[model samples]
Target: MIGEPMPDPRRSIIDNLNQQLDAFFGAGKSVQVIPSGVSADAPFFGTNSHQLKLRAERDKLAPAVRAEAAKGVVASVAAKNLRMHVKRVTLIAQENGFRFADNP
Candidate 1:
């Protein structure tokens, strides 16, 4: 219990981001196709959660996602930025059901 180390929240957030980027990033904004590979917008970050373990890894994805955005799509977002954006979006998703000290 006390001796057990808590898992990284960044890792958790990143996993959830990958899972929900479709909804969070908005429709028709995916940069890459996934799974079936039918050349459509999907939320794959050009990589996986393991690669997203550090700040450098998170920052490394910015350009690619931004490039997609420049092309009117959003394929892969960086982890930290993605995490921040996801929080903001989910807040809206919950219809302002959640709050924090900063918001209060």
Candidate 2:
């Protein structure tokens, strides 16, 4: 049994961000639209050098994707931290039986 609360807001926020990323990257669809005449196994390059070049390009772009994902993770962590701080403050006030009454 994990000693954590159920439905953790942080996890939910992260999950939402990941879903948005999937939509952004089009992970649900084909990477490239193949023409009707093109077969799935068709080679993208006639030479190994061309294939290696494409692979290198993909590797270069991977870092940017990771950076974006890191941003989302940071945001979710910040939100969770803020929520926890607020909850602690509220608990402290409740324990002290503090009350605010506006008087004009």
Candidate 3:
């Protein structure tokens, strides 16, 4: 196996996002880590219009609805001790009234 390309040890952005989805949907399976500098164009499992609807509706919601949604997300994160650092960071951001760049 010498000089053969070894698998990347780092996770990719898509994998991280899928893990978040899995976690949100009750963590059925773990995401396989893809190596850095690798490209994976595969679609995710359990991806559906409902997820898209939720994402779209989030932006159209009023400020109060958004705040309530943030609270709900924070409450869920607080209730479950998610191992991902990004999830914890998201919880922190939610508590601090900040959001991911994708959010409105």
Task: Predict model 3's lDDT versus the native.
Answer: 0.53
User: Once superposed on the true structure, which residue ranges of model 3 sit more than 4 Å away at CA?
Assistant: 1-42, 65-104
- How many pairs collide in each candidate, listed in order? 1, 0, 1
Q: Relative to the true structure, how large is the alpha-carbon lDDT of every model? A: 0.47, 0.50, 0.53
lDDT of 2 by residue, 33-90 (tens): 7677677566654546776775565455444334433344432342254443434333
Q: What's the candidate order when arranged by decreasing TM-score?
A: 2, 3, 1
Steric clash pairs (candidate 2)? none
> How well does candidate 3 match the true structure in TM-score terms?
0.22
Candidate 1 local Cα displacement, residue 11, angstroms: 46
Candidate 3 lDDT by residue in tens digits, 1-104: 99998765565667888878978768566668989666556446545678677555444433533454455554344334333345445544454576544432
Error of 1 at 64 (Å): 0.7
Question: Which digits, one per residue and each the tens of the lDDT, describe model 1 over residues 14-83?
Answer: 9888879867567657575466655445547644556445435435544444443344322223223345
